[model samples]
Target: MKMRLEVLLVVTAVMCAAGKPLSKAAARNKLLLISFDGFRWDYDQDVDTPNLDQLAVDGVKAKYITPPMLTMTSPSHFTTITGRWVEDHEVVHNMMFNTSTNLKLPHKLTLTKSQWWDNGVLPLWITAQNQGLKTASFYFPGGAANYSGQVVNRVMVEPFNHPNANETEWRQNIDMVMRWFSEEDFHLVTLYYGEPDNVGHTKGPDHPDRKTIIQQIDRTIGYLRKAIDQHNLADSLNVIISSDHGMTTIKKRPLVDEIILNKYLNLLKLASFEILDYGGFGILTPQPGKEQEVFDALSNAPNLTVYKKNEIPESFHLAKSERLPPIVVVGDLGFNLNSRFIVYVNKGDHGFHNGEMDMKTIFRAFGPDFRRNFLSEPFDSIHIYPLMCKLLQIEPAPHNGSLTVTEEMLQLHSGGSQRAPVSVALPLLMLLTFSAL
Candidate 1:
């Protein structure tokens, strides 16, 4: 009788545990985050972006989302997904330190499967994989096959170039994403379009051709939206449009004379200083005891803000990392960092901080689950990751910012009643000991 009673009790407990309700929200919707690189907010007025405008009317639009430091591709993209500054994530730029000594590091450091690890942070794809949700990326900068292994279900490598040469390649990227949406089950997807950014880099943000490219991208979004609706997937689909950074037009290209730089180099008794080619500038490490003299000379130069690595602005969040060079140089807006070997003929550059507004990018979210005809207080792009987790009904990882999903947006709210508290199960030994004594 005793053994039979025990068996019955075990069965009852198992049923109770199995029947327990989860504390998470129901993840019934799919998420798509699309990055239109170098897209400026003003472009909306310049071009007829009906789909994006519709998203704004049917969802929430945040007027500004400031890009994280260097305001470049690699770091800004990482910031959007990681919800942390590049200094914390350790992917400060497209090219980073390879460490003087070769030794295995954290999984995050392994930038590529083949190379030794370079970064030290996990991106959102890894987080989604941990939760057993399917994630996909279409030609995102950081989602290259070399870096995204088992973390992402599909990754397409499509480089940015003129549409004339890369139109077929670009179309292939769109076709692959559409096919995946039609065939596979994905919880999260990220798509990247690089034409506007490429054109802005070569021509300028205000270039007439940029408007044409914006229209092309808008048409692509229209096609995707139409496909979803035609397949009756609108209720379960969500779309987010954002950008890496904004672009500024340049009118003057500065020249750095080799003779002047060499004079300083000889006086400093440096073995050799590597001058970066093109308008992009870099200074190789100087011999010991000459670092200060080299920095002082650059500091006195016109149209430059020279800062020691530690003195980089707190707003930029670049002070904490060792990946930064000992001395950092920033050029004024509309100016490029030039070296003796090369000159910049055109006027357009990013990656340098002019001010907060100049570095701001666009953020828009639209879907059945989002709040419609609303706008939230401008927040950092880092908030997007946590917000995504919330929308997907996953336990949010600790983040530096709060995600505000207002009740009006969702059209639901608790009527001043406290939700029931939930208790997690204790280990068997602890439960047994605490049961009676």
Candidate 2:
């Protein structure tokens, strides 16, 4: 009787261990989130992109993806990942400044420091990890930093000094990402390449060199596809290709004294401010009791619009945070806040506004989860975060986008199927069996 009871207990323990429900991690779908900085929606139309064109043919293509208000790099990128706008995510500008400490958090630090990135909201990587999935990042902004006291399983910060190294690194990056995918623990991945945006700044969007840069990236896409096929992950992998925001041509530079704040507001009285004579926009922080004074001075400034912090339109998502400057000034189309001594005559510029065609970027989805060869109506980029969460079979953090908005772009398998598929369950069960043994 004692021997029989012992055998039964062992059997019961095995059965219980094997019967464990499909966890979020075991059921998670694999995703590769790729960001090609400043790759505009119409860029392919301008340049021949065979790889990108093939991706469009194979999966859903959004004609143009609207970026968040301000349409800047750090803001829009964080918006896509967090499903929150610039104001909500707290990466208001590429360079975030803390008024209280008089500390400026530049782009480089924003990549590695928790103080710069962890603003109460967890990004998708952290959220995925909570559900048991592992994440890796390759040069994606915000991926290098600690989010809510945790970092991804793997992180590689692309060096800024070696800008030219990107071309060579593209092939290497694809190999590394494929390696992560082969790891059972790595369920989500992100890769970033800053090009055409870089070229656009120097050579303008229409320049031959900018088009060449796009072509170069397209070839990298082809290499990625070939590598994935070789690794037999073509069917299992889901790839999302996107860009932060588009670039627009800039020529006009306002004289330094031409700026209302520079012209009238006492510079010594202000806490901290940004006003470059060459760029189309700037922000200002009044010391105290000077909000109205700064606002009044910038009132009716030609070719520029100024707004008090509270007065900025809610749709822009610019006014709610204390991190925002007290006075925000935006330049009209083709105009920048240039000064008399130094002029900004960059060939291309962004941060104008989301409505501008040049500020509109690309969104193309390719993989098992998306519908094939479909062209979607232009949609907001924020919806992407929800789509990503839905694909990974994980819960998304509280985000502003509605899943219904992006539902049409996905296939049946990608939607509402939180249960682990038989394909995944079998492997998980085997692993559990080994663990029990």
Candidate 3:
């Protein structure tokens, strides 16, 4: 009887040591991702962004994170969430091709739940959901409509310009996020602010109005921080702020002339060619036997580099799906390509390959789970997803590169540990036990 009791005690101790129960308070902690679109890292104008600056000073600041090739809203947001580049997800731009179906119109593109899963990609919200945590987003680019086909716990879908127009929309969105934060069921929320990007695009980054817009955005950040404090959720919530891409002013002549393109169309015997503004120049699809001819025509074009699908840079990690045009064209600095003949030339635009280091955007994090007074070395935007996953105590979706500099920031907050052992290991063991049963 004594020997049996000793064996039982040893087994119980081994089990307790190997798999401990996680503190509910720690496991239920939250993550908030905020995207301040079109925000540049070097815009050190003395604005009213005390709260955002506080975040920078208190957490990690990722300097010089490069945007994707198109640098468009959809692809940038997707890359930030998915840890995959434009090509891998088949979403290269705000306007994308649904090659799964032979549809050309937006309405014909049915976004079913399986579509998101079939892509082999999962956004941070989805990952949180899989961990049995509630998730929400307000007006994220692709998040406007339910891509997953299932309604997220909280989703705010309204036109960019609605009744609560201007900065008020941003403030209200943050308010909604605060409400969600107070909920015991919720664990993750995402808020997107489009004013800086919108105003920056309409009136170049140097425009006088840009200053006012940044100040308003800064105030909104202050409001959000205040709300977090008022709700007593500061310590339990991790706030991550990032931007989709940076903006730039365009003063140079259009690099690819529409007329020159149309004139050369016959030489390549192509069916259709479209010139995207801000150097997203590409051939949609060429007629049979014209692939090589079109490739040759644009390969050596001045101020541009052309590549066939297979020849694109490996670093880009874009997919080889049919959504990608057979030929990809990228413009050099001080150049843009336009298909729509607008009467007036826009003074400001992003999405062009300007090769300017200043064009890199900003990434900052604040909360109990982040490091302070540190700057992440220049890294790609795709690195953000892995770091976010790690901070949330979840497994990251399989990705090519490791985590971003923000991981170092998170480690500092987590006591220089790779992860919070209690938060990570406990949930993993529970999940495994449930699966086994």
User: TM-scores of all models?
Assistant: 0.77, 0.84, 0.80
The per-residue C-alpha lDDT of model 1 at residue 102 equals: 19
Which of the numbered candidates is closest to the native, going by highest TM-score?
2
Q: 1-437, model 1: which lDDT tens digit per residue? A: 66555655764564565464331344467788889887765667778889778767788788777777667776788788777787787666555444343122332233343332225455677678778888887766566433334446677555333352255555566566656665687787888877677788788878888888888777776777776776566787777789988777764524433222333335336523333322222334455776777677766666656676677789878889766556666666655665543355555557767254656778887777776777766667777877777666676555554555333334222221233222333345335444532
TM-score for candidate 1, please give it: 0.77
Candidates in order have lDDT scores of 0.63, 0.77, 0.64
Candidate 3 per-residue C-alpha lDDT over 363-392 given as tens digits, one digit per residue, 9 for 90 to 100: 778887666777778787878888777767
Ranking by lDDT: 2, 3, 1
How displaced is residue 370 in candidate 2, in Å? 0.9
Q: What global local distance difference test value does model 3 have?
A: 0.64
Positional deviation of residue 227's Cα in model 2 after best superposition, in angstroms? 1.3
**TM-score, cand. 3 vs. native:** 0.80
